[model samples]
Target: MKRRNFLQQTAMAGASLFTAGQSAAATPVYQQPADNPFNLNYAMHDGMFRNSAGADIIDQIKFAYDHGFRSIEDNGMMSRTPELQKKIGDTLQKLGMNMGVFVITSDNWHWKTSLTTGKQEWIDKMMTDCKTAVDVAKRCGAKWMTVVPGNFERSLSFEYQTANVIAALRKASAVLEPHGLVMVLEMLSDNPDLFLRHSDQAYMICKAVNSPACKMLFDMYHMQRNEGDIINNIDKSWEEIGYLQIGDNPGRKEPGTGEMNYKNIFKHIHEKGYKGILGMEHGISQKGQEGEQALIKAYRDADNFL
Candidate 1:
């Protein structure tokens, strides 16, 4: 069944928010402050507001908009049916919000045929995924696609591995460039075996790809966990970076749940005048409507950096 149909079939699509400690008249779980817009485009994913909006992806988008969110990103969007994809695109267009990165090919998260392997089949898959991404972007008004270079090949020499990744990226870039879509490489902290693990490494790969379509994602949570020099690395790679993903370390939740000073970080990015989307890619720290409301307040608090 299409997600849209499943949503309508079950009332989960329109579940109302109730207070955590007190059950009052059903009220929205989140609402933006009177000041209206925040300084940056913090893109939220489907379940970020699910406690309030239930399982309806469209309702979640509407709830985010009502609370001042102006962008949405779904990493698994490519898997969504085209009709659902178009519905999401139309809804975002009507709200004048941005659509952020969806994964080009993340099936390699479990150590599959990575770019490092220099395998013909893997390279062909990369090209095919990039081509598929263009049509996906066209239907959904997306301008960015997330690309993970996959895990390192244990037997391959590091130099040859780097060369193979650059070659694959160049080919993928050709497919995305004409459509004005960017392929942003993400650095993961979930595993040490991953090929692309640092901001500078991604920056180097982006430079080697040498195309406007190639850029760095600069996910703060992973980088912070992998390497502690967050602000400095961000400054060094500022030019090559295209997007940002935020999560508090220790636990991958919204800001303030961990030790990182997101207020200062937000201030730094805003000071540099970054105009792209910063994806809230983490889970909520608290559960239910109260937790959802807390997540909005967290952004509000962090955005106070300006």
Candidate 2:
């Protein structure tokens, strides 16, 4: 394994242990004072800052908050122990920071279960998973959960596949809607074979579901890869988009390291009156604390355009 990946696994293992003793209501370590400039809506990914803080989740949260980040996103929020999830939620709420998106359908990717399969077992498992997501979301005070519909089934026609996806989402929406939680379908450009690849497709699905709880997680990195018109596509799907995720193209690294014009894009999103979190799902291209600091600076520069 690569040294960096090994180090990451080690750090996460250690920090996951440390969170055992901290009370859910413990005072948050990193609350920004009222005077900070960039306190609006930014998120921190768990693995990205592990190297900088020796795997302490609280320390990572504090570090991000002190540096002006007001939100944090953990894709594996449901996988953590209940105590840990409560602790994380308590810290963010106490610190006045928002909790960002967590996963609702992780097993779909892991077990190769496509919603387009139209099998009773897959539908049953997905509903059970949504119930689990609701419990996690309640504990973490999270309002948005990420959903991926999985790969396209080779046996199905394109139109049939679309209909199958819509049916699955509509069923998922039933559970999420009653709990006042929204499930944002992520359009991943990373996998071309996935059912949902474009903003328009996602928008169509969201409309088909016809629930306030169904929306799109418009990821800039993947969108930039799948389609080039980032700003315009966002505007076109503005009404249906519920959340945003960030990573620059070419490297999947920090925001400023690639070709996307984040400043202008952020400005456009801000102009549209978006009040949700932007999940910082990219990696720091450089090594050590300095590299992490550089990533922080990049967000500040891009976010300040507002």
Candidate 3:
């Protein structure tokens, strides 16, 4: 049978069994595990369990929550229809799950001159995007959104570029702060030409912006690839870090599938009293349902450090 049809039939059968006072063993539906077994709030993204949950986004979310995840993040939330966004927000609220960061995106975001040029047009676009983000955040119950300052303008001096980024972010912050939302600056390792490539750089920009809405997203995968001392960098940038993302280095996969020791890192973050969500922003190491199951087991093993 088609996956969606099968899922619908399974749900109906499960409801019938429960209504008939049938024993749990009589139902053939997938059993839910204990909720949130991990000490930290690890946020899973959509498509992470498509093989098991089918194509429906809501079903995928319910699957994640049922399998011991307490948070969810979608990088493309802004592009979703308003109706879908509201449904997502309502569902998350009903499940009592935390909503994590979505990218603060725009058409001009990819241009090298976007933020580093210090152009009014770019800043205007950013401000407009920020205002739009406030609405998106309200619909999805998200407190944090990811911001990338785009590529570097080589013609401009490093100081000038930094100043431009800080100025642009300051404007964006003003738009977000009043609404109790934050734009977390993510330092990526994907492109060397990217202006924000280091933790200290992101921290400096956040400090220069100096607003509650402007903070850093200390992604462990990027930091591990960009700089080896994950724990030390996190400590140094701790004051400015508003969010965290996870992916094992060398493979950019789930915990235990790569070189980085996630257990120790998770333990350290928990010890430091971080109550925020850590986004599971990576690919599954294996394929199909087995891969999804292994991904959960990897997190469970890594989270055992507590």
Total backbone collisions for each predicted model: 0, 0, 0
Candidate 3 colliding pairs: none
lDDT of each: 0.82, 0.77, 0.82
In terms of TM-score, the best-performing candidate is 1
Question: Candidates 1 and 2: which is better by TM-score?
Answer: 1
Say which prediction, candidate 1 or candidate 3, comes out ahead on TM-score.
1
Model 1, 165-224: lDDT tens digits are: 999899889888988889999888876778888988888889988999999998898899
What lDDT tens digits, residue by residue, belong to model 3 across residues 207-299?
889999999999899899898799999999999999999988787789998899889999999999999999998877776556777888888
Worst 10 residues of 1 by lDDT: 1-10
Tell me the tens digit of each residue's lDDT in model 2 across 135-203: 999898899998887778889887887888789888988998999999998887654577778999999
What TM-score would candidate 2 get against the native?
0.88
lDDT, model 2: 0.77
TM-score of every candidate: 0.90, 0.88, 0.89
Q: List ranges where model 3 is wrong by over 4 Å.
A: 1-32
Superposed Cα deviation of residue 154, candidate 1 (Å): 1.3
